[model samples]
Target: MRKIIFLGALIGLIAFSCARLDSFLFNPYKTDEYKLDAYDGKLQFRLGPEFDIPQDKIHLFSISSQGYKIWGIYIGDTTTISSDTVILYCHGNTGHIDYYWQRAKLLAHVGGKLRYGVLIFDYRGYGKSEGEPSEEAIYEDTKAMMQWLKDKGLTGDRLVIYGYSMGTAPATYWSSHDGPLTPRWLILEAPFASAELMVQDGAYFVLPKQYVTDLEINNAEWIKNAKAPLLLFHGTEDKLLALDPHGKTVFDNHPGPKQAVFVEGATHSDVPVILGIEAYISEIYNFIKSH
Candidate 1:
């Protein structure tokens, strides 16, 4: 009867983990509250007919992510993929690629010249991407993106990875794990140290420690082996993760050539504009050129 009892216990454990899987891995806010097609004059850019349709600027494409379709957009001219230095912009947890096109526009101006191209995408379960969200899932999806760039002849130093907020997971993951495919320059903005720390601080700080699942982003451990020149920026007044715990920890843990900027009085999403576009661009360009 011992074998039967053990089987029952194992089944119960699997059921519990399956039930909590989505809760642990993703915080997807699936709502039609935002439709990028109607880019109101009030907002800079939207993914809808009103915006991209007018200029038809965004080139939409698909990539295979674990047997499912995931979406990505090229924010500049079609030739820019071949001509310009590309930064694959991995955005934060909430919202889709439509919400981040404005960021693409800002990153296009590299050191006062339109030198950099931007590619932004929605992970599975975020925007139009297929399947559910998980740490490995996001990593493979982003790996497909790097392959796309290689196929387009953008290789080695020409490609850069930039991660914002929750997007830092895949950004750090690829840079640390992707061997030859890894780019030399990595730009991380408001990065979380790890999955558990992020959920602990943001979700349930008061509760005791628990290992609900193996959803480890592991940015701290990943950066130790990352040889690339890392440019990290964090806001002092961030409403989400505090600079002292999250960003600072990641910066400290990195054992490579790195530089960090602490923006005074700036909160999350304010790194670009708060420092003034020209100066911020200069900082980015200097990091890119020198590295």
Candidate 2:
């Protein structure tokens, strides 16, 4: 009986220690500086392939925000027509903008087919952008990007926001808020319900969600209030995101024109390919046309 009691106490202590460490890692304040440093190196090494399009065709610029600088790649008709619509892409969490070059190429190709501009950027700390990545910082960065685009004359009525994976937070938050610049359409790929729930499900594996701090970007709450047209894409066999409940939760709660496509036999990273790139583009084009 004494041995059993001692073993129980030991187990409790171990669990407590783990929980404490998880909380530390999740704490935005504690992780910010370190993450910022890491982002700098990542950005440097991940520069996108150099394409020599006419200066008028592509514009590369950086926007300054509190504690960060966001880098962007703008591709569109230089003619600057007043009624031109554009797609602003918020890429998934990963290395940098260069990693998304292929996707950008695809967007430009499809944008040409659909006759819309496509602008994609690296979040602060992810690509050539400066600063560390945090939930709040990403939200602010996205707002800055939108403002920069709007200042160039793109308005909400002519804008579509695409959020992939972790990018969903800021995209959803902006859409939900009562603001002057709401996107005409919002697209989420493999979106999780909430940061808290995402962590709770052991998605990261390395660290539990409970350990993270500043779980401010709750999509489930935000999606309930969003008014823009929404489209969700998730893989049926997504092991990384646990597709069913999270994706379903968002789809059900969203109060707007919405569609969800489940790619059969698709894992987290392969949904776009499995769905067929051409078909995917067509679906998006059709959705935009109908809405």
Candidate 3:
């Protein structure tokens, strides 16, 4: 039985939180949306050690929600921390750090002209991270990592939060709710409307909206409060979540400075390719610089 994180009942149907319905209606893999632990489970971060390991793997473990350990890797050369901008990437559901390493390398170069470092982690229950996965738990994992960055002298407008697919939830949640810890920019690639809406096409609408376990992302409710510039990108040919109510909907909901980029023939995860990597990076670079 899945633990209920919120309400006991909703609209008089069977009461279930989104966390409970998560596995039932979404792809458990990608929906993991969240891993991070160092080479070992130790909490310390070390510089390039003489030991043989994967390239650019700066493994660090942070105390996550309820004290779980989050397994993450900082991809970039040693000069990354000294760079003015660091992108804290919240990846989509599924897989672990190894699965995202290639892309992490690419994203780490997004603001190369300005020298940006990219940090991506796996949520608990995914890869090397500890504990189970849940709504609030994932946010706590992000907070733990964000705090880790803060403690290392990274703060203020120097940070950029990037969310892909299901990751938009944590990115937006933390950006809007983190107070002074807020990022200078928030970017969402292929964001969905909400948990209930996300499960609709895949779950075939079998569950009533009212009773769909409330793994609610509810980005619409939070984007309005974001203090940083928001960038939303979605494919016109998205085959999973629709573009209208999901991407466009959230883009419309944002109340702060923002830009919406629609790639003509792009599909989910291929926006960078479709838009031309140089062009895409330029847009992001200009956005962050202007703000």
Local accuracy of candidate 3 as per-residue lDDT tens digits, 26-99: 33333232322232322112223322234544555445556776777765543446445788888777556655
Q: Is candidate 1 or candidate 2 better by TM-score?
A: 1
Candidate 3 C-alpha error for residue 212, in Å: 1.8
User: Which lDDT tens digits does candidate 2 get at residues 160-242?
Assistant: 88887778877888888855479989988888887677776665364545566446557888999987889888889988777
**Comparing 1 and 3 on lDDT, the stronger one:** 1
In order, the Cα lDDT scores of the candidates are: 0.74, 0.71, 0.70
Worst 10 residues of 3 by lDDT: 42-51
Model 2 segments more than 4 A misplaced: 1-56, 78-82, 111-114, 203-212
Candidate 3: misplaced stretches above 4 Å? 1-20, 24-64, 77-83, 199-208
Candidate 3: residue 169 Cα off by (Å): 0.2
Worst 10 residues of 1 by lDDT: 44-53
Best by lDDT: 1
lDDT of 3 at 166: 76
TM-score each candidate. Answer: 0.81, 0.78, 0.77
Quick one: ranking by lDDT, best first?
1, 2, 3
Which residue pairs in candidate 2 collide? 22-211, 23-211, 26-212, 26-213
* The best candidate in terms of TM-score: 1
